[model samples]
Target: MGIYSISDLAELTGVKTHTLRVWEKRYGLLTPQRTDTNIRYYLDSDLKGTHAGVKTLQQRGTNFQDSRNDCGRDGGGM
Candidate 1:
């Protein structure tokens, strides 16, 4: 159970930090934990949702909302 920073997740997932933030804000793709300082941190489970892979997390459609709809609650394809 490793905790990861946004940069770490971006590096591991090959997605930019900006995009990761957008996804979290727009799509509810990630559920990062907040520290007392209000800093966001990710977990190994965040990197890999239930059964969804890293590639799945990186897949985005024209608009994030649409992609999110397709990528069910677990961020896996419907």
Candidate 2:
């Protein structure tokens, strides 16, 4: 288990940093934790969640525009 910054997630997942932020802010896809200094960070779970969401989307043959709906919605999406 490790803590990851948004940039780390973007690099590992091939998603842009801005896109991740957008997903977090607009779609509630990621739920990052805050440090005592109020810095945002993610855990291994977030990375796994993203991968699961992507796989779910692919398996369902969901189009890019409609895929967000099926994403776990409770802060568990790509």
Candidate 3:
């Protein structure tokens, strides 16, 4: 399994690194593994799950611009 840094994940998911950190802390959407040095890293499944959640919310009428903001404010995941 490959692990990705925050920047890599943001690039892969089209979400900002700050937003990703917010999601990680607030929504519990991602559970990145910690390296021996305590650096955070995510697996491919994390990206896939985040993408799936984004798609689901889009289908539910949550615009991309608003979804992350809403999620951050509401503390809701998925």
Candidate 4:
């Protein structure tokens, strides 16, 4: 039940903020919550939806370093 900003999501999920915005607009990837000050924040569930390995790591209590490998950033298909 953690809260994260777009930049935080970008770092954790390895997805750029611009791409995230596109996904949100085109694919409905995330439904972000806004604060009283109108700051966007995302829940932990959103992070999991962005990547399967993130969900698995949370379930297994593993660190996030390995999750990056699952994101197909290393010349693999996502």
Q: Which candidate's TM-score is highest?
A: 3
Sort by lDDT, top down from the best: 3, 2, 4, 1
Task: Kindly list the per-residue Cα lDDT of model 3 for residues 1-78, writing each as its tens digit.
Answer: 778998898888776787777778976888999999999999989989878877786789876557757645744322
> Per-residue error at 20 for model 3, in Å?
0.8
Clashes of each: 0, 0, 0, 0
What's the ranking of the predictions by TM-score, best on top?
Answer: 3, 2, 1, 4
Count steric clashes of candidate 1. Answer: 0
Quality of model 4 by C-alpha lDDT: 0.71
| CA displacement after TM-score superposition, residue 3 of candidate 2 (Å) | 0.8
- What is the per-residue lDDT of model 4 for residues 1-78, given as tens digits with 9 covering 90 to 100? 899999999899876787677567655768889999988899999888877744665788754444435453332212
Pairs that clash in candidate 3: none
Name the regions of candidate 4 deviating beyond 4 angstroms.
53-78
Angstrom error at residue 8, model 1: 0.5
- In the predicted model 1, the residue pairs found to clash are none
lDDT of candidates 1 onward, in order = 0.67, 0.75, 0.77, 0.71
Candidate 4 residue 37 Cα shift, in angstroms, is 2.3
Tens-digit per-residue lDDT, 1-78, candidate 2: 899998898888766677677677977789999999987899999999877876776798874456545554432223
- Report residue 23 deviation for candidate 3 (angstroms): 0.8
